[model samples]
Target: MNPPKRPGRRAVCLLVLFSVWWVAVATVGFSAETVSSEPQVKAAFLINFAKYADWPSNAFEKANSPIVLGVMGDNKVSEELQKVIAGRVINGREIVLKRANSIDEAGACHILFISNAEQQHTPTVLDQVKGHVLTVGESPEFLEKGGVINLVRKDQKIALEVNLTAADKAQIKISSKLLSVATLVKGKAN
Candidate 1:
């Protein structure tokens, strides 16, 4: 008789990430597209992270204010996110996608995404938005630059690297479920 089999570690990890990704996508009604680049995936993660993180009341100007994603120095991610966020509301607030060219512009958002294109200005931007924004980045040195959550590539797939110190400083409370799937870091840097 053949033995019963369980899922492998890699399969289980993929399943968890995929399930979170799917639920996030479903919440925003993200349309299925033939994504051609990493930007799209990062956009998805940005939305997913936004759903999982909680910010202070001051992050929003009003109770009905939008949850804004201020994407810095990358139009592709911004554009793809616009599609996913179009007319979507979460926790009774609308989702707004925007592009930012400077730290000042990025500071006004609930969620800030710093692209590799803006790597040189990451420190300044991270400093500007500290204690309020849910910061996400695609660069390897993002968490080191004082960002909260950084997306990384592992085994040819995208994974999450979370800096709890940064998140705590930013006052963004990330769900334990989200943290369970991430590579957690401590004490400001990885």
Candidate 2:
């Protein structure tokens, strides 16, 4: 054939992309300002979460509808998240974002990201999602308050704090790979 197509342009482009992704996460080490730096990291987390989790049949199995990402309280974080996950798809479903003032309104989301504004109402919200949704937050007390994933800033980089107990109670299975890199917070410890 024609010079046996070398591991050329396509491969080079992929390599570059991979390099960029790595650099991004490395820089995202522990800062909220840089939180938007590695969009792929967030995407990877969502994808992995889907693989390890078992969503309620009504939300995932039967209908096959889009997986919804819900944001409660803070509008800034929601806006940032929307920009990052705009056109991304996970598990054969397009990702959609919904804003809610109350947990009752956000009940349908597969992942609920609670903002600092929601702190005062977290207990009630957590109660509503006790055995259902996966809760994510950026508050310092997130893990202590039973949130499944806490996004914390450390050494100016963004790190994750995971609450296995909360995830287990919600019937959401977090991947060991994710847990391995994250700081595990057990209710008993604190």
Tens digits of lDDT, candidate 1, 1-190 = 2333556766777787899999988866744556346778887888877778998888788999888888888888888897788877788888888787766677778888888888888887777664478888888878887888888999878899889888888778999999999998663531
lDDT of the candidates, in the order given: 0.81, 0.70
lDDT of 2 by residue, 92-181 (tens): 777777876665666777788787778887766776664367787778887777788877778756688899888877777787887887
lDDT for model 2, please. Answer: 0.70
Off by over 4 Å in 2: 1-52, 56-58, 61-63, 188-190
Global CA lDDT of candidate 1, please?
0.81
